[model samples]
Every structure is written in C-alpha cells, then in structure tokens.
Target: MSKVTQHEATGLDDLDPATAPARDAVHFRRIVAARQQVSDAEDGLREAVQAAREAGDSWTIIGAAMDTTRQAAHERFGRAR
Candidate 1:
C-alpha cells in the first residue's frame, strides 16, 4: 500500500500550512480531543463487554455484535472480567 499524505487525506493539496498556523492549531486541538473521546469510548466498550459476559453472553455473540471473530473478541476483551 502507498502512503496517503495529509493533503491527500483532506483533499487540500493547495492548503498552505505556513499561512494557516491558527487553523492548524485548532485542527491539532480537535485531534487531541477526538483521541480522548476514543479512549473514553474504549473504556465504555470494555465495561460493556464485561457486563455482557456476566450476563451469560458468549464470545460468539459478543464478537458478532462487535463485527469481529470470537477468538479476536476473546483475545481482546476476555480478560477484562
């Protein structure tokens, strides 16, 4: 696979970074906030997985819900409980 440059990802090949320091800063801040939100969501997902296990849900069902394989789900979250 080839690398996708920031301009490619954002479809802004003409974007001028030097002239957009404030906009870049805002984008960086938003990225940080989004990462934190993802972390929180992951924690919630782990808790939900544990709760589901406690409720007699099998790894297969959990995996199906998560769009993953049973082994993958078990490997990732089985130890949470």
Candidate 2:
C-alpha cells in the first residue's frame, strides 16, 4: 500500500482504508488526534471569549486579540457569552 501525504489526501474520503489496512490505521489514529486538538482549541477559545466578556472586555478588544473586526468577533462569540 502506498502512503498518502498531506498533499495527496485532500480529505478522509480519499483515505482508501481497505487497500492499506496498516497505513490506514495509522492515518485514522492521527486524524482522530488532530481532530481532538482542534476541538480542544475551539473550546479553549470559547472559554476565553466568555471570560473576557464577563470581565467587561468589549468586542473591539476581543476582535483585536483575534485579529478580526469587532463585529466579526461579536457575531462569532457573543452568543456563547
């Protein structure tokens, strides 16, 4: 079975598991690990945004911290707060 690099596999659907059981196992494991990392980061961001709101930080400040517009930050994380 051939190994699929990041450029080769556009997504998990391109991971032909049946043809490469061992490699697929490793790829699937790594995919889960990467996904967990992303999920954790997202949760952390949400928590931080909520905390900032509770601390009276305006959307403008949060937006600057996120390198985005004030409206964008408020639109994305305000509801969570």
Candidate 3:
C-alpha cells in the first residue's frame, strides 16, 4: 500500500497548469470559502467577547488572550456596539 501525504489529501498538489482555467476556478472557490470561514470566525469572536464582557471579563484579560495590549483590544472591539 502506498502512503498518501497531506498535500495529496488536499488535492492542491495535483493542480496542473495545462488545465489553467479549471485550476484557477478551483483555487478561486477555495479562496472564497476560506474568506467566508474567517468572517464567520470573526463574528463568533465578537459575540464571545461581548458575552465575556457581560460576565465581568476585563479588557486586560481579553487582550492577554489575544496577545495584544488592553488598549488595543478595546480599540479593535469596543466600538462594535
């Protein structure tokens, strides 16, 4: 039995330039899907932050969790409401 690597599992390593149009379409679709996923995750994070604040979590704690300063966290997320 042959071993299948991670690249083969994702089909990205199999893209051929000879099929440039089809390959480009597939890549574009993947990019769109990835962007949607990121947007969804950001929305979830915003909601979680709101809930955390309601539960008495501080900017200092949220900033630490995000690897940023308290002021930075506040600047990025505080105005969402």
Candidate 4:
C-alpha cells in the first residue's frame, strides 16, 4: 500500500473559502472512514495475537512477527484477553 503523507491526509492545502465547506465535509468523511478501518484492524490484530499465544507462541515470537519488541507487544495486548 502507498503511504499517505500528512498533507494528503489533512486536505488543508490551497483550500478556498468558497468551496471550503464542501471540501472539508469530504475530508471529514475520509478521516472517519480511516479511523474505522484502523479500529477494525486493531481488533483483528488483538484476536490474532490471542490465538497465537493460545497456540503456544511466545511473546518474543509474536513481537518478531509484528516487527516490535516483546515488551512492547505484551504491554499493548497482554490484557486483551
């Protein structure tokens, strides 16, 4: 997936007052959709991590799969269950 820069996400560049309200509405919808997607993804990740732990996977292994430190992963998702 391509990365969206801050400028692209904010929709603030070259905004004119005449059409700003319409443009801002579109931007607000995009932000809301993005936030929902992120929330869904986090829920899935938590479920996957819980499954992996139940299947005898260690925090180190799970963290490696997530490309993060073991402590970080545990701290974030340990109480998820």
Q: What TM-score do all the candidates reach, one by one? A: 0.68, 0.69, 0.69, 0.68
lDDT of 1 by residue, 8-81 (tens): 98777767778765444788789979999999999999999999999999999999999999999999997734
How badly does each model clash, as a count of residue pairs? 0, 0, 0, 0
| Full-model lDDT for every candidate | 0.89, 0.87, 0.88, 0.89
lDDT tens readout by residue for model 4, 1-81: 999887778777667878766634788789989999999999899999999999999999999999999999999989845
Regions more than 4 Å wrong, model 4: 1-24
lDDT of 2: 0.87
Model 1 alpha-carbon miss at residue 51, Å: 0.3
Q: Where is model 1 more than 4 Å wrong at Cα?
A: 1-24
Candidate 3, 1-81: lDDT as tens digits = 999997898897877878845534788789979999999999998998888889999999999988999999999899956
Per residue, candidate 2 scores C-alpha lDDT tens digits across 10-44 of: 67566576885654468868998999999999999
lDDT score at residue 23, model 3, on the 0-100 scale:
34
